[model samples]
Target: MSYRFVTPIPKRAATGSVAAVYSASARELGALFAPHLSPAPDLHAALWAVLRESMLAGTAPRARKEAVAAAVAVVNRCPFCVDAHAAMLHATGSHDTADAITRGEAPDPLVAWARSTRSAAPDPWPFPAAHVPEYVGTALANHFINRMVDALRPGSLLPGGVLRAPSRRAAGLALARTVRRTITPGESLALLEPGAGPAPAWAGDGPVATAWPAFERAARAGGALLGPTARAAVLEAVAGWRGEHPELGGWPGSVLGAVPEDERPGARLALLAALAPYRLTESAVAAWRSSVGPRGDAELVRVLGFGAFTAVSRLADRVAVVA
Candidate 1:
């Protein structure tokens, strides 16, 4: 089945601090996936940019946004996200507040009342009738899942699940796979290389040439905006490399090594994948299937995707509120 994907918006620059933050986030995220597969870093980076753009343009509070994210992770059973968000709460000195809520404890009167309201647990000992909207709870659940997705499978943020989701669990697994692939053996070596220079002739000239454009096109279709110069350079570099290495089927560590450190992470990789010429590589496809294998429920996958979307929407809203 052909999957629908969002193309990157054609723009000159990312432009704002939030946008830059999002880009950096994408890069870091991509680094997480670089080791496992050929296309993961690119996918992760592209999704990060798309989600950040959406959030910066929306109206939500960051704290509430994080709470919602926490809720989703709890429901999804994603330990990584739960621990990470809990740490975030702790850093903000809200550990007591969050922990109280999570453990079903007898919190101090004032805090207990608030936790009861937030968790929507029926009042055991009533003080005042405090009502929490069903939607609020729903939003929290959704937010949690979305954040997990953002952290784990940024690529799935693209409009359609074309490259990633064959089913809901498959989608989640696809995201997990993307995360796995972002960190690779070559990143350290790439970082140690002298002055950020263009890729070696052997690195560029090969099957990488054909694959790069396909990847780039996918990224553009998925909402990553690339400047003219950046786009042109990528195209030229990939083309030259493809001409040199006709046997290459997947991207090499050196290709990433060649990228300037500033541009070498998730966002750049996503941009490269979106603009490259190949479909999800065989390794990526296989890994995605394996990751989601244990959780066979498609509904869970849909919930995860929807949760991610909601979290991002909320984050966008919060950023707007402060701006």
Candidate 2:
């Protein structure tokens, strides 16, 4: 698939760490997300590591987490992920549930909770406390993926922008074998250097506990491209968000008023990706590119991806506190 911001590293062209991660990820999941991430190789590996540990390796039923992924995609308005994960949810043998999710319906309590993750906290905490790591990880993964896909890829997964029922069902059938395959935890961690951050209180000692910090660290590297003032502006804006989706308007434009004229483009792009991605515009990206002399696709993806992930990470922290 052609991407908007970055050229995907084709499988045949992948080398070194990117090659290893692409091979393992394709064998385990599929090629959709990893290719889009290949421009930033460490971010690619770190995210795959998080998904492997949280979704693929968990003892909790993968089907439930798949459901959560789809539901979160729905809330985020990321059609690419909603369709992709709905197919994966179908591969888990929850055919009716997957179909319902594709129609924008929450088929169960777990899915309902996932849908509400951005807007509302779960009061009494649902599900077995033991399943927190897997569930939260899955939601966080989709939250990040949804924003990236929205910013980078087309809304549909297949060629010609097709995403009808028949095509979705066929995609599910193709993924069934891999979705049902057994995977070992922490396998993808080999791609990352070990870090010292302790697991968050919500994630016990599971592989996800380690994987999330790694993903966050790699993602945060994008902030290096942002001026300190720009970075602080984006974070402060995200902090003021009430979890409700922001209405499209002058706010994304005005929020960056404090940013220097030269830095506003990048800062604006980051803020939109984090709080209101659907509001992103062609002019917004063009502005950033016009200002950046030599910083190309990798830098663009980093700046936007960092913003998106930071928002979701904060949401995960909120979920942890409520739980």
Candidate 3:
């Protein structure tokens, strides 16, 4: 199969029904990133749960939130996300505004704020102080997921006009519905306590604020599985990276070279898989899968997801601090 996946997709039988809902939505959207997550349902659920709270379960109007999401998608160059978010805007009778955002135009101050953060610019908090939490949190959350999905999806993604027709827009709205219903705001925190991690003060005191703990839990889970040496190497390899730019950032020359040669490729791939998947290659995927065997594949998924969560959320921390 040419390594259709480096890790097993979250199967209904393996991950149970709750994870299956995420699987179904991912399949429906052709979301390349979701298959990689099936191996770690809790992490996957945690990611989406945070996004749902930050973007949806807040005081911001639904259309405005979708517009904010569309703007973030435009900056991340994720057409699939642009479509999904734009359609949500359309469903809320803001199709014109959605159209503008998909083209990279900042329709308003809030959308502009999201774009500024993408370029590592200051988060001026153009919107109300109360809205900053969800807005910026959504920015940070989508930035993480967009990187993973864009890295895995085909170069030329879905066309923009598919939803131009009224009926097609309705279809997109339906897709968004499936994604919304997958997990509750705090469903991922069912077994864990909120407010466990000491996050930055800029974290909005909204539904999404608790995401810090979920992300912390995911990082700890992967850290436990990977051991200290691998964890340190991954962090060192990605030092100084902000996880904003799509390209590799200050990639240290082969951080895993100290390990066994056979293990080096897997270790390095794991680092990029976590920090910058846009640089992932089929050869690398093939090598890592072949070397790791099946068990290593699942472990790698946890490592990458956790790694991305940390890197992406770190950007959020910085934004919160600066703002």
Best by TM-score: 2
The superposed Cα distance between candidate 3 and the true structure at residue 158, in angstroms, equals 3.7
How many angstroms is residue 14 displaced in model 2 relative to the true structure, after the best TM-score fit?
1.1
Candidate 1: list runs displaced more than 4 Å: 1-23, 26-42, 50-59, 104-323
lDDT of 3 by residue, 96-153 (tens): 7877886779878778877766554555777777877677777877876766565455
For candidate 1, lDDT tens digit of each residue in 50-110?
Answer: 2222211123333343344444444433444444444434434455644543344534443
The candidate that wins on lDDT is 2
By TM-score, the candidates rank as: 2, 3, 1
Residue-level lDDT for 111 in candidate 3: 80
True-vs-predicted CA distance for residue 58, candidate 1, Å: 6.5
Off by over 4 Å in 3: 1-35, 151-170, 173-188, 191-196, 204-206, 223-230, 242-263, 293-297
Q: Looking at model 2, report the run of 10 residues with the lowest lDDT sum.
A: 154-163
Q: Which clashing pairs does model 2 show?
A: none
* Location of the lowest summed lDDT over 10 successive residues in candidate 1: 1-10
Under the 3 Å rule for N, CA and C atoms, how many clashes does model 3 have? 1
Backbone clash pairs for candidate 3 read: 10-38
RMSD of each: 21.0, 1.9, 4.7
Cα lDDT for residue 78, model 3?
Answer: 72
Candidate 3, residue 254: CA error in Å? Answer: 6.7
How do the residues 24-66 of candidate 2 rate in per-residue lDDT, one tens digit apiece?
8778886534587888888888888888788878888988888
